[model samples]
Each structure stands twice: as C-alpha cells, then as structure tokens.
Target: MELESYRYIAIDGPIGAGKTSLAKRLASLWDAQVVLEQPEENPFLADFYRNAGQHAFQTQVFFLLQRIRQLQAPLDPALLEGRFVADFMLEKDMLFAGLTLAGEELALYETLYLQLRPQARLPDLVIHLQAAPEILQARIAERGVAIEEGISLDYLQRLSECYSQFFYHYEGAPVLTVNTEHLDPAHNDADLRTLLQHIEEMRGKRAFLNQGG
Candidate 1:
C-alpha cells in the first residue's frame, strides 16, 4: 500500500500490549512523525497503579490533560512533510476516565474534556491492540516497572474490559482490532506485514486481525 494514502495512523492498546514498538516501526517505514503518549509524565501514575482508589482521579486527570496538550499542538514538520504514526488514540481517553474516576470526579472530568477537546489532525486509521489478561500481566512483569509491580490480574481484567467496551462503539474513524495473544507484532515481522495488508484492504467501520483469520 502507498504510505501517502494513510496520513495519520494511531495505534492503541492496554499496558504491555506493544503499541509503541509497532508505532516506531511504522513511523520508520513511512518516514512519518511519531507521537507517543508519555505515561511517565503522569506524576500520580506510580501511586495510582499501586493504590488506584486513592490516586485514581489525579492520575486520570493528569493523563487527560497531557494528551490533550499533545494533540492540540500543530502538525510537526515530519507530519506535514509525510505521514504520521502515534502510539495512543485520543478516543481512548474516556476508557481510562471511566475505569479510574468516580461519580463526581467523572462528571468534572467530562466537563473539562468537553471544553478542551482537541481540534488537530485526526487519524486516517486506528489499530486497537488486544491480548489476554494473563499475557498482559506477564509482559508487565518482564518489563519490571516498580510502580506496576503490584498490578493484579483483577485490575488488568477490568482494564481490558473497559477498553473492549469503549472500542465496541468507537465510530470516530476506521478501526482495526488486533488480537495479539499469540502474535507478537514487536518481534514478529510476518504479523506486522499481515496487519498492514489488512489495513490496506479495510473498507468497513471495523476490522479484526486475528490469528485464525
């Protein structure tokens, strides 16, 4: 497929799902600009991951605000000159919000999000990555982030559910849902190429890239 045909590609997934690796590869192949969500920028992330109930609102709000700031910025030279690949989807913002915030906190966040909705370039295509909760947990352990060390399977399960629910109705753009339980796009070139082929052939509102299919 002609890379120029896809000016903006957004890759989204839960933690340890490998969105960043694929985004980097795609950006290099297309010579496109890359936008990565800086999860480390959330000062409350460590604490929130350890004790979500106590720090959930702060962590969620911090990420929401930071992502909005990044999204609102003008197209950089690389994007203006060529295509762009991003590791996060702005639409996923609400997934985290719903998972992390409570009644009053969520209401406040919704109001703020409405006011600061970004008006920048939108994705021509989105790749929503998925994996089994067990696989996600194992990957998290291998990476060994101190803050994430305490993350339980229960939490990951809930997070995966939230992501699934959010994307179930996502109609903002063309979506390609990839089940990565057995396929590792990061180290598997064949899997990546297969997905690229699917992206090129996609014409529907949603597409699924699964192992059996």
Candidate 2:
C-alpha cells in the first residue's frame, strides 16, 4: 500500500525507540494531525521510574485515562486531506502494566483497560520501530530527558523484547517493522527519506525495513 493512502497511522515501540520523533516527522511531512502520549504530562512517571513498586499503578492509570481521552475523538472529517498519526497504540499500555504490575493491581488495570479500550480505533497502518537495547540506551542518554534518567538498560532490554513479542502476534493493523539499529530517521533527513520510500514501496500486509535503499 502507498503511504498517503493510509488515513491513520500509529507508531509503536519501546521507550527510547524513537517512535515519538518519527511520528512527529511523519505527521509534519504529511500535514497530518498528531496524537502523542504526552508523557511529560504524566505526574507519576518520574516517580514510577525511580520507585516502580510504589508508583507503577498511579503512572499506568494516569496514562490509561489520558490516552483514552486522546483516542476517543474520531478523526476530524473537517481537516484537509491528511492523516492522523499517533506515537502509541492503546493495547501496548497493557504491555507495560503486565511488566510492572501484578496481583490485584494488574487485575484492576485489566478491568479498567477492558472498559476504556472500546473507545480506541485501530489505525490503518502501524509502523513498529525496532532497535537493540544498547542503541536505545545510547539514544536515551544522548537525548537526555531528565525524567528518563532513571531508565535502566535491563528495563530497556525487557521492554524491547516485549515490543518484539507484541508485534509478532499483532493483527489489529498492517504492521511495518523497521529496524532502526542502522537508521537514524529521527535526525537524518536522508534516513527519513529512505524510510518513507520503503513505506511507499511496501507491497505486503507485513514487511521489514532493514538496510536503507
């Protein structure tokens, strides 16, 4: 399928995978409306990173509510010929909850997720970014978001694995898995063009982008 043919595109990946940057760039390039996670707005995020046991529930709940609000609105028909691009897909929130929460907390989170998830719509296309944990860690450190200072390599490794597993079985939308280990679409215009070209050239429901064209 061609890139512009997709009216809604969602980008998914583990933290530090550069999904947000790519989402923003694609939205801008296509003149599309962008829906992002807005992680900075989550008050419990920093605390959760520092003290996951004490703060995981609050952080996850905050994201669930906030993201549902963002996802509930139907794509604006009034907007010009453009797409809606979001940095996250709703179900992956469960991935984090599963990783961090357990027992009653997890059960409660699942219950709430089931209730709120009906509002979210699947995107026509999903761009799933992939990168080694070491690369992700380096990018995270270079970007130097203070709240991310607490991110651990081990956590990133686990998150990357979870992302890989999640997308492997994902059937909600056509997914394009792009390995970013050798591509810097976030910062390099050439690399971004390479990705966009691959996106447009895609001919299957599932394709992988490894080396640039």
Candidate 3:
C-alpha cells in the first residue's frame, strides 16, 4: 500500500465499526508499530456503561488522560520517528465526551480537551469506517464484551450520527470514508485488497468507499 510515505495513519469509527481490526492489519502489512485505545484499562468503563449517569464523568476523564499519555510521543515526529497506525484519533476523545457528558461536566471536559489538543499530532491520513447501526449492534452482540453488553442499539444509532457529522466537517487531514456493513478486511483477503486499493486511490480532502447492498 506504499505506507512508508506516511508516518501515522488513523483508523476511526464508532464502536463495532472494525477500526481496531483494520488498524492492526494495516500496521502488520507495513511492519509498523500500532497504538490502540486501551478501553480495557479504563477502570470505570464497566460501571459507566451500566450506569452512565453515575459514572460518566470519571469514565470520560479517564479516557481523556489515557489518550493524551499514549498519543503525545508517537504522534510527534521529533519524539518518535517510526511509522505507526492508530485505531483512534486523539480528537475523537471529544466525541465520546460529548455523548456521555453534559452541562457542567461537559464544559469541564471541553476545557481539558482544548488545553491538550495542540500536543496531539495530526495523522497523514484518516480511514473512517462506518456501518448501519443495526449491523453494528449485531456485531457487538456477537463479540460479547460484557461491558458493551449495556450499549443499546439506540446509542449506536446516535453514535453513528455523531460520527457522520464529525467527519462531514472534518478537514484536518485527508479522510477516506468506507462503508463497512459488508466489508471485512481482517479475515477476508479479497476485502483487504479492495480496501488497500481504495487507500491508494484516495484523493482530494475526502473520499468514500461504499459497497452497496
């Protein structure tokens, strides 16, 4: 895929959108280091998912700090010169914070986010994977992550909308949006090849790969 030209590539999407899978595949193909969001390390995630009203603030804050620490170095060329593939963009941290926080909590989160945003480096390219919320829900159910068990189809729908809006206006870097309801790159060789071609074909500020049903 001629990935050497780009130092860092970000694979982004809502939960169950196959971002982590694709990011790992791309990194492996290029023999590059991969940085992934460590949701499993978030001590408040399960409780927050089960009872968002009670734990949302802590959950969001924990993720914000984690993202900063994980991304600060590799994202900057002077600190880390090696190529890397990241499953989540540092800015997307605000997307989740917006969804789970509001009023005073959201205001505070935004304050912290803005203060730290500059330290995070922009990726050379961003691959945005999207799918129908129903498809996303089914995938989540199949994966059976106990904490995510509490994630409703309604939430997935809302989250999908949020992602769409975010990417629609996002111009920080080149974005290649892919409809993944029918694409599985991690396990299917042909699908991965098709996706790689899409990446190579990407042009302009925005591009799309929609495998119609």
RMSD of 1: 2.1
Model 3 weakest lDDT span, ten residues long: 1-10
What TM-score does model 1 achieve against the real structure? 0.92
Residue lDDT tens for model 3, 1-213: 354566789999999999999988988888888998889899999998788889999998888889888887787767766779999998888888888888999999899888867556688899999999999999999999887888888889989999999999998888999999878887789989998887877767898888766
Candidate 3, superposed: residue stretches over 4 Å from native: 1-3
lDDT digits (tens) for residues 90-184 of candidate 1: 77887888888879998998887777776666777888999989999999999987878878899889988988888888888888999988776
Where in model 1 is the C-alpha error above 4 Å? Answer: 1-3, 74-79
What is the Å distance of residue 19 in model 2 from its true position?
A: 1.3
Clashes of 3: 0
lDDT of each: 0.82, 0.86, 0.87
> Would you estimate the TM-scores of all the predictions?
0.92, 0.92, 0.95
In terms of lDDT, the best-performing candidate is 3
Error of 3 at 14 (Å): 0.7
Better of 2 and 3 by lDDT: 3
1 versus 2: better lDDT goes to: 2
lDDT of 1: 0.82
Residue pairs that clash (backbone atoms under 3 angstroms), model 2? none
Indicate the residue-level lDDT of 63 in model 2. Answer: 95
